[model samples]
Target chain A: MTATTLETDLAGLVAQASEGAVTPAQALAEPHSLGLLGLTSLGFLRLIHAVERRYGVALDLDDDVSYLDTIGSLAAHLRERGV
Target chain B: MPTVAVRGAPGAAAPLTWGQYAIWAAIGRTAPNDHYFNLTRVLTPPDRCRPLDPDTALDRIGTALSRHPALRTRIVPAGTAPGRAPAGTDRSAVPPGSAVQQEIVAEADVAVRTVAAADEATAGSAATDLVEELAATAFDYGTEAPVRVGLVLVDGAVARVVLALCHLATDGHGADILLRDLRLALLGRTGPPPGDPGTVVAEETSAAGRDRSDGVVDTWRDAYRALPPSMFPTPRAEPQPVRWWVGRLTSPALGLAAAALAARHRTSVSSVLLAATAAMVSADGAGDRAAVLTIVGNRFDPSRRDLVATLSQEGLFTLDTSAADFADLLRPAWRESLRAYRSGYYDQLALDAALAQVSAERGEQVHPMCCFNDMRLVDLPPGPAPTAEQVRAARAATVFTWAAPQPLVGCRFCAHVTAAGPALTYQVTGDTRYLPPQRLRAFALGLEELVVAAVAGPAPLAALPARLGGAAA
Candidate 1:
């Protein structure tokens, strides 16, 4: 899949896993707010694993995901790698 | 033979050992966002009328080990098999490596073996000795080492077993399944074929892989990496391995009640547990100040099956019980817990390394010597019982992992409760030098009392230790 497609899929996954019962897309978009997305330090981890599987590439979570919280950040992340 | 499945999401960076980093980096030939920490132990009946046969035990452990492929961790590469690194987009790709993929024993060089001890006390002592020796292979970082076998002598007859695994390969629930298989194996029951569930996996992991922006943890690594030389000081002596101490507390029904309380409190069982621990830390560390670290398990994903890697991060919650109006601390704690997940910034291992480096540069203690862990939620996936290993009346048995790590703290609080289990189990490990066993019990009871009290009605604070003192002893 193109990096862009992969990014969109990941956005959907993160939004779906929103812990606070918020809309998946919103959770993907504004994960920084409290109560909007009940994502925990633990939830971030599970998402990484899921995305890695869907994309089929080794993701340096330390290098990438740690900085990408919102979908915009994630898209920017993909853009940086020429995704 | 036993079958183990890990169900959790992996994060950006969890508190991983160097051993873990090296292994993943070596295999993928690039960094991958997958790591797991697991604890496994084997127990025998309380007494032994029969001296457990080593061959039988080895067979049991081996059969149990056979079910899990160390190489079960497959990475779908970004492109063709072993082609050029897929540009930056598919920067890395791979087929399972010999070390990490296609095997249950991640590294046979360091995996564990069973040794029959002379007796119970000997077995107990031997377990540590073996751990210490085996630990020498990878001292600092906890890896996905194979099933480490230790003996638990029950009545000088049947040798109970202990399987101390690196967190990468197993978890509390998986460990329970392994133990059940071992117990059945002891009675001569064989499990399903090796790799039967995730059996038909594509042997050659496709190189065409995914983007790497999934974030559950935010390590302050880059910020630290960018820090001036002055912020990263040189270490004098390597961290001296101090005598590790451990303690235990049984929160029978207490933990579940706390979970219910958490539901009322509008948080998770883990969050409430952390809040109570925050109170305990604030109370204990003199000046009502403390730094607390909690494990955040990311097993929410349903697609990827290998949940065993060190796929977690640390959630840092600083409780300044010193804050005026102790009750108000709840709002901030709740907010922090809620935001921690949302912020996706608290990377477990990277941030820890960064903080440690920064602390050392400033010459402060690198770690918050004591920590609290509340593994109260279980991620056991329901499976149709294979008609193969049907043994009834066999209550699902589980090994207390936090129990084994107790010896390492001045005071450690471990609280875990399974949905199916009846009790809220806590293991408190400590030494006399830090505090007497009784006093540790007091601290645990005090914490439980505190949690229960808060759950009851946020009433006047009561002395937890004094209330539950006699029961722990």
Candidate 2:
């Protein structure tokens, strides 16, 4: 998928995972930190599950979790995994 | 005793969901005293709400049961796989074979025992007794539904409704949902029913589900290998007559101090309490590394959020308390807590196999028989930090006492944090052989002192043992 499309999809997933508490615009604007966008621990887990379901790629939570600190980093990691 | 017949839409038999399997394993371990797993709630309608007649209450309960199939579900041995068990077979005595499945019945009879009381005050006392009586017996999982309902009638109207639910049917969160639904049903409100358990079973059996279980097993293996052989390695005192004793510390000061620490550190109150407990565990000579089996409510998925099922499982939480100050431990505790909760959802059989493998590798059993359960549904944002004087004043109202003795639990050290009116209550039930009543009392007090001390200023980690009245580190 294209970069823009992937990010758009990711934003939607983030919004859904947060139960609409984090809007797509807010997710896009706060690309550096999803936590800053008000995503809770449960919401983070849901977002990971959504990403796995969408791309058939599992995010290794035990590894360095820095990539998960931001939407941009997560999108890059997914693409590097050939998503 | 009178029985109320509840009829619901029946579901085909399927393998027990992962959540059900987890509780099933615990039930097996807890056996005859399995009633300990029963979740009981005595709910009295608010005074503003209309008083409900016994017949109306029963009707509302039946409606609620019909809406949630999990309330009508039963676990049976695999021998009775395709259908219900034979009418007269002893369901509890039947040993489960290689597999077990849960079945939802179209209709089941629930016992409704009514206790007549003269006034509301009398009814309140009767309700408490009814809860104990209704929850004291284990459910026959193979034949009987997993719910018992009791009504306390005062002046020909229902004053309180008591529900005793088997752990196989639901956990604390699910019980809350069921109670909410019951209230709504009583008020004649209607909405779409919660998700079904069969769907959960199907999802759990899928390929992705297997992969998730594999990942969880891997996490468990790593945690087991790192944890000490046991959290409580040595017995400090002789075993009590009851083998276990429960100690409770009810303190508004602890709650205020913990909230202050949580706010200052930008962490959660659960993490603050966990850090304090770990400090005590380390000071008590368990080791610098504290391992606790934390209960995880696996309702992150929206689909399972309101599902009335036992979706809770244990997750491994380990913390290294080599830090210089107590404040430094909060962030790591919060991060590790998140990881532990994430690893909680998995197949119990797979986890068992993993534990066996780890135990064999270590040449001994590898289990952290210490647990921590934060029972609050939501951790509201903490207000501004309370001043030291305010916290000290609140400390004057703290109460620490020994509750009733309990039968042997599965764990040696179990700590539970629950809300008690305006204050917070910490109950530490431990094996007396490992933790004597004195030590249990110290542990509870130390939990309060640690947080309160931290709120006042930086509490030195090394001084915790001395402050807690334990041997110096």
TM-score of each: 0.49, 0.89
User: Ten-residue segment with the worst summed lDDT in candidate 2 chain B?
Assistant: B377-386
In candidate 2, which residue ranges exceed 4 Å CA deviation? A1-83, B46-49, B95-99, B385-389, B467-469
Candidates' RMSD to native: 14.1, 3.4
> Candidate 1's residue-wise lDDT over B366-440, tens digit each?
444344455643321112211212211121332233233221322233333334464555555444343344545
Give the per-residue Cα lDDT of candidate 2 at A51: 91
Task: Evaluate residue B246 in candidate 2 and report its C-alpha lDDT on the 0 to 100 scale.
Answer: 95
Where in model 1 is the C-alpha error above 4 Å? A1-83, B1-38, B42-64, B71-145, B148-168, B173-245, B286-289, B304-306, B320-331, B338-353, B360-363, B377-421, B431-439, B460-473
For candidate 2, write residues A1-83 as lDDT tens digits.
89889888998999998888889888877744566555655667788878988899867756456566667888899999998
